[model samples]
Target: MAAAATVVGLGGGAEKQHAECLPTSCSKHHSPKIRFPFRLRGHHPKNCGYPGFDLSCTPHSEYPVLELPFSVNVLVKNIDYTSQTIYISDPHGCFPRQLPNLNLSASPFQLLSNYDYYSDLSFINCSQTQDQIWIYRYRYQIACLSDESHQVYAIDSMSLPDISCTKMYNMSLPSEIFGYSYGPITFDHLRLNWSKPECGKCEARGKNCRFKNNNSSSTSKSQLLFNGSTECFDKPSMGAVLGPTFLLVVVIAIYHVYRSNKMKKADQVKIDKFLEDYKALKPARYSYADIKKITNQFQDKVGQGGYGIVYKGKLSNDVHVAVKILNNVKGNGDEFINEVQTMGRIHHINVVRLVGYCADGFRRALLYEFLLNNSLEKFISTDKEKNSLGWEKLHDIALGIAKGIEYLHLGCDQRILHFDIKPHNVLLDNKFTPKISDFGLAKLCSKEQSAVSMTTARGTVGYIAPEVFSRNFGNVSYKSDVYSFGMLLLDMVGGRQNTVAQNTSECYFPEWIYKRLDQGEDLGIQIEVDGDAKIIRKLTIVGLWCIQWYPVDRPSMKVVVQMLEGDGDTLTVPHSPFASTNPMPTRGTTGGRTFNSELEVISESE
Candidate 1:
């Protein structure tokens, strides 16, 4: 744990500051020392510790607590300043419970490298009866997280065991933990190491580390010192001894600064050029002031994503809109250009309307017509929500989304492929009409082109087609979107993420659904009426058809729309799509068919 470094002299003032920052602990005997680069919150001044290294004491237990990014607080067991390592344990005593949301990228510390000291561990939760039968076969069972009804265990294998167990999650842990032969896994503590502040060498040399510049104010000095501006010294006279070396360091620093500024200017020029070229699209451009007014200073936050935040706002005519403010745009502004240029030329009932855009300086935003209902994700995320929409409504939503994808693929003058199409991206209007949004990952190509060349895979993990990741599956094409829509339809029917392992040992849920349908078994869903059962079966069959292993084996969006709108009795179970074993027919057929025979002309490149 390294706190922000502070600039101080080796004289009287320096000695006073050091005395104030003297190592202290939550308890007199057991607690670890907290000093430079690590400070107790509310007890030490801001300059005493480095940024992101602040710790607090538990009110009742007196145990030191370290809160990581994303508000995860872990109890600090020990701090080895000499080794630059901090040992922590979950405050709730179950580290596995927090593994899903544990993020270390934003924090100063990092887990030990996976190649050397760490190994991957998969957690599986199973019923008590199954646990008893298989518990002796596995290495460790997390007793604290287990109960009478179910038991949780960790295994070294990446794939789930061939049994009725639900895969909870996966994480990397110390390699030594899996080697233990005797007892249950305690997960007693985790070791995290930090590289910043570089105080280990100073500690090894038995010398104190302090910021080199003593003339600046404490706040500014902390900022600079955190950027590796500190020096190792024993006394005030050491400064005079190191003056020449310091001067050389200053020269190198200046050169690096000049290069950084030059690069910034070049990036700015590229952004300006992009904005200028995009002006021809004739999208309504609003100033930053207008954005603030329209959003009421960003008061109503509607949603958030990796690229930006969406806020609910109103136009001058009182029409509601969703304003997405983009953040951390790259030097090329490729996403902004793709979204505006692609959405600007599109107008369809099932596609969200881009009302306007803002390119004020470095800040950019996209305005869209606000939908009353949030997204399709909210309605089909849980059992209750899924039932609230009923089987018929869910069928309609599936049909609407298919039509939207059909419009993007065939109706547009140029074909538009939505690389990312999941439940979250489909917004719902007041009438619950689905509108496909988020065109940042969309690609446009000539109508005659069948496949699009992709340098990298772009889409949500579970929803992405197999071809997008590798060429062995097939060339990337509009059929890729059909694969995603199929996954979405499965989620709507299953009322959960389709990628999750079902009751069976199979890793893929679609395979399980296919097996059930092949055996003519009920989908184990709560079907309110006979019609509901047919809708569920129909959605499942169509979804399985769309997610075929190869792009050629999957049906076109046009056929998908027809399947969803047509009677459920006419649909047929598709070939097993788990592996690239069975290739479906290329022409018109019940399972799947290509919409354009000319588009089937295969090539290495689009």
Candidate 2:
């Protein structure tokens, strides 16, 4: 009986240890589960995980962080025991900055071999004067590393280019690093795998890998037992010991499943209720089968955005259309409801026409008339494309866009605020007429409402209004749309997005344009004719007027349309939009001639 008691005590102690080493996570949702060969350092016993696989929770964020050799720390995104792979990323959001000192040789993890090929890359920092020369020779310029006095570039060739540049560092990186020609180079996550203590087979069989005899010294030997001096054992089981506890878990699981089904049904009912009221709008509704037939199994993808992918399709009447298949998992049907409610009531020449919709089951899609020309983004991206559409045509396109925005604010029964207004959202027809599309982030309010409430900042970064990001700037209203349109016009004039400049010195393009105009200098852009120069000046001055820092100082779409329609002679450059001084009056004057003196003061409303 004494011997039996000793055995029972040992079993109880083992179970307690097992409970302590069970799977843990830094966050309930964001962080991955830490288990087996990979264990949380401070949360679990050192013996629970394999050597060189220890991770810890971040001090503030509580995110799982993996510390590699040389004190290089990366965020732990995921761990797959079955595949023996771990995904890690730079905690500071710049992997290239860490690559120079990243010494994976001292660590057990290695880059994924079968997935990607790697090459040695040398980072070179050169003087700013050599930028034009280097940019002409090498295409891979590292924007993050480049600064005011110097520029950084990555070269994959054997010898560095014959330029006056210093080699910053050399490291072996994936081949994809060389593929990016523009924008910042980034990796979503770096995949690594370990082969020291192979526990994949044990995991496949639903068993746990542990040191044989619970002795850490035996883990070094490869020929000791079932798995390289380690042993596979059944996971600790409480089902046999605690029947009532198991029953309670089962009941809780069933209740959770019931609750999930009830939630899904509730969502479905809400959608049905909206659709029943929306039927009166006269927009045709199609089933999922009809959607598939129209899209021909989504074969020809025309475009894709944050909301969904667009495919070219044909209706029963043989009319060509662009079908946007929205992401089903996006935002509990708010975007779909917004589009249906707003676009269904809207009818304007500048706005894209909504032909039909599909809300069959979980799948949702919106149909619109197919425009042969893609988006305004493609046209304004390069100077060659901008030249193809002469200054006069570009001016007309800007006017059309402003008119469209004006109609949305005044023409519709309820004011529609297009939160996202960038070149990508503006589609062009065969005649090159600009029509605003993508109402996914749109909001509707009464025409009398001057401002709107926003839980989060919406719209593309470069074109987003300052007020939309923070209320301290000003209240968000139709003026926010004016801000975006102003940025768009500036893009048309500059032949590129204003946010993306060649160097750090030229980072704020608007401020640069403002300074040049203030100094009585001609905008240093290619000018073919006097008419072209006048149009450029007009667009620039109007864009500056629209992008004032405060919403109260910005002109309404009504006033903006007037500015775009007027010839370039009378318009005067507005004050510096980025001025640190007190807010300037909504109306300004040059030579006692008021600039946009007709500007209306819109009261704050939500």
**How does each model score on lDDT?**
0.73, 0.72
How would you encode candidate 1's per-residue C-alpha lDDT over 71-183 as one tens digit per residue? 46778888887788988888778877777756675467987543467767788888867736556766478888899998888876754568878888777777765554834
How far is 117's C-alpha from truth in model 2 (Å)?
66
lDDT of 2 by residue, 46-146 (tens): 66676567766543444576766444678878888778888878777767777754666546788774546886778888887773754545546677777
In candidate 2 the C-alpha lDDT for residue 151 amounts to 74
Error of 2 at 559 (Å): 1.1
lDDT of 1 at 45: 69
Cα deviation of 374, candidate 2, in Å: 0.4
Candidate 1 clashing pairs? 3-37, 3-49, 3-50, 4-49, 4-50, 4-51
Top model number, lDDT: 1
- Residue 430 displacement (Å), model 1: 1.2
